[model samples]
Target: MAGYPQWHTASEQGPRARNADAVSAYAAAGAPGITFALADGVGDDPGAGRAAQTAAAAAARTPVADGPVTAILNAQQALRKLGGTGDAVLVVAMPFTGGYRIAWVGDARAYGWDGSMIRKLTEDHTMAEYFRTRRQPYSPRMEHVVTTSVRTTTAPEIGTTEVVGGGLLLTSDGVHKVLPPATIDGILADPSRAAATLVSTAIAMGGHDNATALFVEPPEVDVAAIVTEPFPTAA
Candidate 1:
């Protein structure tokens, strides 16, 4: 692979009772692969944050060959094994050829910011998304209920896309739910500060839950080195 994976991971408690969100990133040693994961514990359930942390750790520690979906499955199963009090949404990302692959459940999401555009990679497993797809009237209350998640479940939505010059982001609803796409698109100014900026923005926008973001800056090839230089004329 010509590119490397660089990551900046961050999280915040927001203005909520507890930080129910977790994020993780790992780069394969001597390999062009990287793995990233984020989870948001269902606030209604006690010990939700613990489940989210467990899922994040499992997903991030997954072997490269096991793949993204497998990692998520591990996370889901791991949480189930813990016998925790709350369920959670799990989102995992990994390098895939020229682009990246994302596997997710529930409302937490993955996004690609390639400088000029901000692309949403995963569809929320919430009623809002369900209604949007069917072109039905969506009630605001429906947003509170997630149709799918890592509640001892195996199914997850998977997406793939080449990265934008900027990078990739995995976010919990605490951040995505509040910040408009334009605001996120505008903040691509610095990927290094993106995680903190996103968390801060979500708080400023009205922090309702624990916010989290994991950023993956794709490796770049030196264009100057790739371009051929003219041969110097013999003196």
Candidate 2:
């Protein structure tokens, strides 16, 4: 690999939501490359925490030859067998030969940063997106609901994209839903505390759900404080 990625992460439970979200990043001796997994539990039970924890650990330890889909599918099965009854949004990223393999279920997402532009690589399984794709009117109430999740029989979509030369970001919906892409891009421009900024900003903005953010680009973070700039007043 010409360029190896450096990684950083930030995850926090939303005090208001009874957060069951979990996140893990690891590199094992025999694994092809490092692995990153993020899971947001959807229910209010002990199983929710178990579901997220199981998925994150299983996904990070998947064999390099098993492939991303198999890894996640296996994770889901493991969760069920272990009596994890809660549903969750799961996203995994692992280094491949030249790029990275990404797979996700529900609304958890993976985004690529090709130095200049940030590209979303996953389509959310939500009703709002469904109506938007068809150019139909839909209520905002449907926006936060996911049509599919890690516990569903549906398969996660897997994609291979370059990350060695640029950057890769994975986030739970809580963070992305609260922070706009433009705002994210500004924070990412300075890799120093990128993940922390995302999580902190989301919570500051009243994100009611657990928030998590991970970045696969590495550097010595600057100790400078990120000042809050004023936004344009509404018309």
Candidate 3:
């Protein structure tokens, strides 16, 4: 069997009274790849933490045979079944043959690190982003107002991207929002310690929200070898 890509995760409650972020990863059943999921609960909601936990677990465990987008949709359905005012933002990443696919909603983000620099892979689903994309001025408060969430009755507009090379990262807003891109790049410079460092540093830098990070190193061997069945081609 071939070795799979290495992965690590770290999460911290920071100064918040309660943590409302979740992270999960799982090997694809009967497939050659793995899936990573992260979710951030909407702090104002009473059931935010539970929603984040449910979304992250469901997204990570969903079969990747249908792709990361479908996995996120499945997670949304799971959140609906939970039936409450609970809401969360989510991001999912899955590696394929020579690249990987990422899907996200709200502000939980995906990033790629290529040793030299780190680049954001998913866009924030917030009013700030919407206004920025339209070249309109917006208040700073808009940044905190996400346009959609896991519990939306209507399907939210999900952000997705496919990329080649480099390591992958999934982060809750607590980490990314507190750290500058250059700071994040510097931490990722040491992939082995990236996850733990990211969470700790975010808290140190005055991040009061729960912080979470998941890092996946580029595969050292073909991911297909990890499974008994022939590797399925990514759609």
Best model per TM-score: 3
TM-score of 2: 0.84
TM-score for every candidate vs. truth? 0.84, 0.84, 0.91
Report, for every candidate in turn, its global Cα lDDT versus the true structure. 0.73, 0.72, 0.82
TM-score of candidate 3 versus the correct structure, residues matched by position:
0.91
Which residues of candidate 1, in runs, are more than 4 Å off?
A: 1-4, 28-32, 44-46, 156-166, 221-235
Q: How many clashing pairs per prediction, in order?
A: 1, 0, 0
Q: Taking the tens digit of each residue's C-alpha lDDT, what string does model 2 give over 93-120?
A: 7666445677777788888887666788
lDDT tens string, model 3, 109-223? 9888887788888889999999999999999889889997777624447778977887888899899989999999889888889999999999999987889998888777655
Off by over 4 Å in 2: 1-4, 156-164, 218-235
True lDDT of residue 33, candidate 2: 57
lDDT tens per residue, model 1, 1-235: 2434556767878667778787776654443455678889988345888888788888877765677788778887788789856778888876655566667878889888776567887878888879989999999878868887776565434332334344788888888889999888777668789888998889888878888887776557421122222211100
Model 1 pairs whose backbones collide:
114-164
C-alpha lDDT of residue 30 in model 3: 74
